[model samples]
Target: MKDYVIGLYEKAMPNTLTWREKLECARFFKYDFLEMSIDETDEKLKRLDMTKEERKALVDLMFEVGVPIRTMCLSGHRKFPLGSEDKTTRERSLKIMEKAIDLACDLGIRIIQLAGYDVYYENGNEKTREFFLENLKKSVDLASKKGIILAFETMETNFMNTVGKAMEYVKKIDSPYLGVYPDCGNITNASKSLGEDVIFDLKKGHGKIFALHLKETVRGKFREIPFGTGHVDFNEIIKTSYEMGVRRFVTEFWYTGEGDYKEGIKFSKDFIDRKFEEALKDK
Candidate 1:
């Protein structure tokens, strides 16, 4: 058995495929699991309202395909941010949180990676920040009861771009259910932009880090950068995170309608596997 788990992000494949097809593709690429995406799109958001039979069918499909979705990237809050100034939006955000937790429970997903943002579209002031904290505490309480982990994803925004920044909320929430799930690419960009070291930033969330997103990024760009074409140092980042006790990783990228999308998936897995091998060889 492998010492750690590696998963593919759902967006890494074409959304046109069904869940069975996606799971087959992930298994074909030798990924240990798949990280389900619940983004800001209405289509993705509708997944939370899935009926019991639909959820059961998905669970059965995982068993049939032999690859399970072990984590969720819940970015739906990016649209209805928890710290919105409008009461209606804030209420919607909390509703999203509750439904996400329920979906995670039904799907047997262990961790839900939350987008770390107080307010994405609007201006973030002290009031918004306070509202964020208040809602965050309530979210954690819901997660704690269900025994699901709700981890912060270090986002590209200035609001919560670093693991250190994410830890502030984790510490404030003070629950085992809340932790950090840093995106290597985003943190790499944040550190370089601020003249800081990525490893140092990761160390700030040492024990609180539940997972890592093994993505590729260059200066100023946050998404869709092909692996190995970017400036991210996957080796050192993986090494630091591994030593810090992170055993789960998900390759985060998009499938931009490439004809050889399978080839792209294979290349990403191989590249990240090499980094993991190098990082954990001596440990």
Candidate 2:
């Protein structure tokens, strides 16, 4: 059977709580791993309020609770373009990524997903593409030194928004540590762009996928609906991923609403378990 891991995004917790309370909630949720977002204001290692020893103690507490960090989702390109000609933002993005890579190394995580260049349209010049590849090579080199995989994720508005384009970019990188984190919902959106079936895109892109983000999006915006409530076919995704030899998955459902977070996680766990069992039965 495949190993399914539950994780909590930083946005899932109440913002008013302290860092200790957030970590405690992750333990209470019984998650096998935790995922954190890396942005300008959310650097995990640069918390001014927590001393070095206190952060180490928190890390120890997480290990004691049997939960390890899986990845740091770097949100560098949401505001600053990694492929931009702007020197200041580009350098700042790389510095932030380097810091995140170091922190992930300290925490023993092997993967860091880069939310790639945030291009508004598909019309990317050769210079822009070259810049992207060069910057990524730099990031990949830094990550490789730390024994970490720098996985790049697709975005709605970018050069590599589709699975085919994402594959092309990764193939150019040609590093074992360089791959794609195939977001199911993103695939669904990109299908419309090509006027093709979503599952077809997923199958074609499965070989290069390093990790899977289980997302259930409704309409254009990602509302984090329950597993079966959205158009993302969980069964097909899981079956295809297993066929591709992908085992680790991160369940992400972030929304501001009336539902209880714990209950949502429980439902997600049960839903994934059933999907895996069904896949095995078919096999």
Worst 10-residue lDDT window for candidate 2 reads: 42-51
lDDT of 1 by residue, 17-40 (tens): 999999999999999999999999
Worst 10 residues of 1 by lDDT: 274-283
Candidate 1 ranges with C-alpha deviation above 4 Å:
none
lDDT by residue for model 2 (199-265), tens: 6777666667777777776557555566787777778877888788776677766646566766766
TM-score of each: 0.99, 0.86
Tell me the number of clashing residue pairs for each predicted model. Answer: 0, 0
Which residue pairs in model 2 clash with each other? none
Top-scoring candidate (lDDT): 1
